[model samples]
Target: MTADDQRTAADLLDAVGPAFGKLRRTALLEVDNPISAKDLSRTLVLNLVLEHSSHSEVTVGMIAELLGSDPSVASRMVSDTIKAGYLTRAASQQDGRRTILQLSDSGRDLMTRFRKHQRDAYDYITADWSEHDRLELARLLVRYVDSVAALKERSRTKEGDQ
Candidate 1:
C-alpha cells in the first residue's frame, strides 16, 4: 500500500479501539452482576466451552492462549469460576493427565441472559438502522474479526520460525 493509504488504514483501525472500549463499558454497566476483568475473562472462557465442548477439549492453557493472558492467571480465573459453580473440571477422555473445562448450568444460564442483554443493547443502539444495514454491519464485523485472528496467527508463526 502507498504511504497515505497505509496511514488512512491505520487511522481507521485505531478508531475501533476506543469504540470497543466504550461498548465494553456500556455492556458491563448493563449486566446484572458486576464483572471484573478476571470475571470477564472467565466468562469468555465459559463461552468457548459452551461453543466447543462437544467437539474438543477446553483447558486452562487454551483459555490462556486465547485470552493472551498468563497461564497462571487463566488457571486462577478458572479456579474462581469453579468455586463459584460456574464451571467444572474433569479429566479429559482423550488424555487422562489433561483436565478439561466445561460450563455449569449456572454458567449457561448466565451466558444466555448476557447474550440477550447484548442483543437488546445493540438493537436499541441501532434502532434507526434498516435491517439490511444491521445485517451488513454484523457480516463486516465478523469478517474484520476473522481477518485480525488470521493476522495474529500468521504473526505468531513468523515469530516461531525466527
Candidate 2:
C-alpha cells in the first residue's frame, strides 16, 4: 500500500471503536422506542439476537461468547432485556431442553426505528459528500464489520483448541 493508504488505514483503526462507542451511547440508541433498554448492552443483546437468529439459535451462552463476557453477565443482560419486553425465551428446536432467545414484537419494532435513525445520522453526517464517496464509505464500513466477524470466529476457534 502507498504511504497515504497506510496512514488512512491507521486513522481508520483509531477512529472506529471510539466512533461506534459514541454512537451507541447517543440518544439515537433509544430511537424514541416504546420499550426502553436499560443500557447499551441491552440494545447490543437485541441486535446480536437479530443478527444471529437467521442462521443460529441465540442463547445466553452465545451472547456471552460474542460479547467476550462471562456467561453470568450475558445471562443478566438477557434477563433484563426480557423484563423490559425486548427479548423472549423459547426452547431450542434442535434441543428441546436448551433455551434460545428471540426478539419480542416490540423488540423488532425498536430495531426498525433504530435502523432508520442510523440511516438518518449517516446521511446527515455525510451530507456534503458526493454519492460515490458516500456509497464507498458504506461499502468499506460493511467490509470492516465482516473482517471483524472473521477475526472473532478465528479467535474463537483458536480458543477452543487450547
Candidate 3:
C-alpha cells in the first residue's frame, strides 16, 4: 500500500474500537426512546434472527458462531431474550432435535421502533454534515460490516477444510 493508504488504514483501526463502544452506549441510552431494549445481546439476537431467517434457520449455535461467543453464553443470552418475550425457541421442523429462533410480535415491534430511533440518531448526529455525506457514510458502514462478515466466514471455511 502507498504511504497515504497505510496511514488511512492505521487511522481507521484506531477509530474503530472507540466507535463501536460509543455506538453500543448510544443505542442503549438514546435509542431507548420508543421502546427500551433489555440489553445489547437482546437486540443482537433479534437482529440476527431477522437477518438470517430468510436464508437459514437461526439457532443458538449459529448465534454463538456468528457472535464469536461460547455456546453456553449464547444459550443464556437466547434464554434471556426468550424470557423477555422478544424471541421464541422452537423445535426445528427439518431437524426436530435442533432448536431454532424466531422473533415474537413484540420483538418485531421493538425492532421497527428501534430502526426509527437509529435513523433519528444518525440524522441528529450528522446534522452538520451534507446529506450526501451522511448517506454515503451509512452505505459504506453497511458495506464494511458485510465485508467483515465475509472475511470471517472465509476464515471459518478454511479452518473447516483442514
| Best candidate (score: TM-score) | 3
C-alpha lDDT score of every prediction, in listed order: 0.79, 0.82, 0.83
Model 3, range 107-151, lDDT digits (tens) per residue?
Answer: 898788777777778877788988898989999999999998899
Query: Which runs in model 1 stand beyond 4 Å of their true positions?
Result: 1-11, 31-41, 152-162
How would the candidate models be sorted by lDDT, starting from the highest? Answer: 3, 2, 1
Weakest lDDT window of 10 consecutive positions for candidate 2: 28-37
The lowest-lDDT stretch of 10 consecutive residues in candidate 1 is: 29-38
lDDT of 2: 0.82
lDDT of 1 by residue, 85-152 (tens): 88989999999999999888988887886677667766777779889989898899889989987898
For lDDT, candidate 1 versus 3, the one ahead is: 3
Please give the ranking of all candidate structures by TM-score, highest first, separated by commas.
Answer: 3, 2, 1
RMSD to truth, every model: 5.3, 4.3, 4.2
CA shift of 124, model 1, Å: 1.6
Kindly report which residue stretches of model 2 are placed more than 4 angstroms away from their true locations once superposed.
1-17, 27-40, 157-162
Local error of candidate 2 at residue 158 (angstroms): 4.7
Backbone clashes (count) for model 1: 0
Q: What is the TM-score of each candidate against the true structure?
A: 0.75, 0.77, 0.83
Q: State the RMSD for candidate 3.
A: 4.2
TM-score of 1: 0.75
